[model samples]
Target: MNGQKLLIVEDDLGLQRQLRWAYDGYDVVGAHDRASAIDAVRAEEPAVVTLDLGLPPDPDGTSEGFATLAQILQLKPDTKVIVASGHGARESALNAIGAGAWDFYAKPIDIDALGLIVSRAFHVHALEAENRRLATPATTAFAGLITAAPEMLKVTRMIERVAAADVSVMLLGASGTGKEVLARGLHEASGRKGAFVAINCAAIPETLLESELFGHEKGAFTGAVKTIEGKIEQADGGTLFLDEIGDVPLSLQVKLLRFLQERVIERIGGRRAIAIDTRIVCATHRDIDAMVAAQSFREDLYYRLAEIVVRIPGLAERPGDAALLARHFLHRHAKAMGRPVTGLSADALAVIDGWGWAGNVRELENRMKRAVIMADGKLVTAADLDLESGGAPEPINLKAVREIADRKAIRHALARAEGNISNTAKLLGISRPTLYDLLKSYDLHA
Candidate 1:
C-alpha cells in the first residue's frame, strides 16, 4: 500500500469486508450510508471512492446511493468516484459517468478490473496536482506580484521586458489598480541605485504643486526661510513617480517639460540650473490623447512622457486570479488579525467571482481584511464580506425558476460544505452523478 486512501460506501457487510481486504494496495475505509460516507469524505478526502447506490431505507431504490455520490463530489470535485451497479442497474451506472464518476462497474465485482480503474484514477489525480503546483510562480519571480492565473503571465512578461530600460514609461489603469506597485517593480527591475520618490499630481494643491516638484530658495516665498529641494531634486539619483499625471496643470506641465528636456532644475529664487539624474514613470486613469486633442494637455509633452505605455486590465479581466487572491488576502489578514479564520465559504468565493470589483486589487484586499475580522465561523461567508451571491430575481417561467432555484440550492450546499463536492451532494440528498449533471446544466464549477 502506498498509503493512498480509498473510501468504500457499500451497505453489504460481506462485500465491504471483501473490498477492504482485496484492495491491499490502498488504505481502505468503509461507510454504510449517506451520512457516514459524507463524513468520511470531509475527513479523509480520499483520492478515490467506490459507491453502491442501494442503502438500508432504499435498499432496492437508487436514490440514496445517488445522493451519496453527489455530496461526495460536491465536497471534493477532484475525487474519483467509482459507482457499482447490479445487472438491472446498468442504466444507473451509465448515469454515474455523466455525473462525473471516474468509471463504473457492475456487481459480481471483478477485482483485477476494478483495481486497474482505481490505479488509473490515482495516477491522473497525481498528474493534475503536479500541474497545479507547477503553475504557481516562484516567490522570487515577480518580486511583488501575486497571481496564479495563466493570463497574468502576459503582463508579467511585459514588465520583465521593460524593467531594464531607461526610457520614460507611462502606466494606464483605473485608480487602486496597483499602478504605483508596478511602478516600483519597474524601478526594482531597472537595478537603479537611487530612491523612488512618488507624488500624486491630483492630490496636491494647484498653487503649491509647482514648489513641491521644484525646490525653492530662501526668500523665494514667505515660508522659504531656508532653501528646500523640491520632489525633482530629491529624486536626483533615482526614480520619480508622477501619479494622476493627467491632472497636472498646464503651466506646471511646461516647467516639467523643461526638466525632461534639459535634465536640470532651477530653484524658484535662484538662477543657477542645478543638474539632476532621475528616471520618470507616470500613471494616470485619464485619456491623455483626448486631453491633447482638446488642447487641455500639450501634445509635445505627452509624446515626451509616453515613450512606452502599458495598459493594465481591471480585476475582472484576470480569470481565476480573484479566487487565488481572495485566498491570499484571507490568509494574510487572518494571521495579522490573529483570527481562527480558515477560508472563504463557497458562496463567498462565488460572490467574489460574481462581483465586478470596480476597485480591483485594493478593494479585494480591503474586503478580505474586513472579512477576516468579521468572520465568526471557521470560514468567511458572503455575509462577512457583505457580498451577495447572485443576480436579481428571475421571471415566473418554470424553466427559469427551476434554474434559479437549482443554482441557489447548489450554491447553498456548496457554501455549507465549504466547497466540498461530496458534502454538497450529501446535503442535496442526491447522488454525486445527479449533482454533477445539475452543475453542468447551470454552468457552475464544483
Candidate 2:
C-alpha cells in the first residue's frame, strides 16, 4: 500500500513539530500560513489535511482559517479536512463543519484523541476515493473494449468467442471504431507465442506492397541493402492484422491468397519458398463484397480472409457509450497532462449523450484531450467539450430527451454516492425503491 499523505496547516513552529512527530506514521507535510497551505494543497493534493482555526492576520479569530478551508475545498473538494480550534469549542466546531470540514477538534491538544480522529478521517477519505475509482464509468467492462452500448457489447462477446478458434477473422466497422484494438485482443486471447504484426494495405504503395508482405532479398531493390523479413514472417507463430484489406491491389491479392493457402512466401529476388505459421485477422471499413463484384478485390482471397466476420457498431448505435468513453478519455488525458479534473458536468454529459458521434471513439478521445487542456475550471462543461460552444443547439426528440435525463440521473447518483447506490439514492432525496425503478427504466444498474 502507498503511504497516506498528511498536510498540517499551522503557524506555530513548536506545535507543528509536535504534531508532525505525532503523525510520523504518515507522510506528513507542513504549511505555516494560508498561502503556503493553498500552494501545498495544489502541489501535494494530500488526501487528508489538518487546519488550525487560529491563523496569522487574525491569529485570535477564525476568519483566516475559514477562508483557508473554503479555498482548499474549492481546489480539491474530496480532501478530508479536520479543523483545530482553541477558541469557543462548540461554535468553532459547528462553523468548521458548516464550511465543509470533514471533522473538527477542540484544541489544548489531546494528542491521542486527535490521532484517532485524524486516523478516522484518513480511513473515510481512503474509502471514498476507492469507491469513486471503482464506480467510475470508464473502468466498467466491455471485454477490453471501452463501450457501454449493448450493440458494442454483443460485438465484444462475439470477438471473445471467436478468439479461441484458429480461424481467419474479419472485422467490419466504420473508421476509428477500434478495429485494431479488437484484432489485438483476439491475438492475445489466441495463446499465440509470437508478435502481433499489423499492416495497412491502403497506406503502403502498390509497387512495394509485395515486398512488405513477402520481404525482399539483399540487392533485390535499390534500397534493399540487406534481407529483411516481411510482416507475415515476423508474425510466424502469431496473428497478422491486415487493416483496410479491401484496398489491396488485385495484383498482390493472388500472392496473399497463395500464402494463405500454402502457408508459404517467396521473396521478390529469392526463388526458395519460406513456410510460415501465422494466423490472419483482417479489417476493412469498405464494402469488400461490392469490390469483389466489381472485380477490384479478389473474391478468392476475400473468402480465405473472412472465415469468421465480426461487425463493430458505430458510436451512435451504442447508447450511453459516448459519455462512458468520454469520461475514460478525460481521466487518462487529465492525468497525463497533470491537470486536476474531477469530472464532466450535467450539461456536458447531456451534450455527450445527445450528440451524434460521427467519428466515433477516436473523435471523442481527441475532443476530450482538447477539452482537458482548455478547461479553466475543476469540472469540464459542455462548453469545454466544444459540443455547446459554436454549434447551434439542435432540437431534441422525446426519445433523445429521455436518454439525456436518464443518463444525467444515473451519472448524478453515481457521483453523489461516489458510486454507492444506497448513498446515491439518499443524496437524490429518493428511496432505494424509486432509485431501482429509475435504474431499470434507464437500463442501468450499480
Q: Write the per-residue lDDT of candidate 1 for residues 314-419, one digit (tens) a residue.
A: 8776655567678888999899889999888877877887788888899999999999999998899999999765333333235556666677667556644645
How many Å off is the CA of 78 in candidate 1? 33
Instruction: Output the worst ten-in-a-row residue range by lDDT, candidate 1.
Output: 390-399
- The local lDDT score (0 to 100) that residue 425 gets in candidate 1 is 99
Predicted model with the maximum TM-score: 2
Worst 10 residues of 2 by lDDT: 389-398
Give stretches of model 1 more than 4 Å off. Answer: 1-141, 390-446
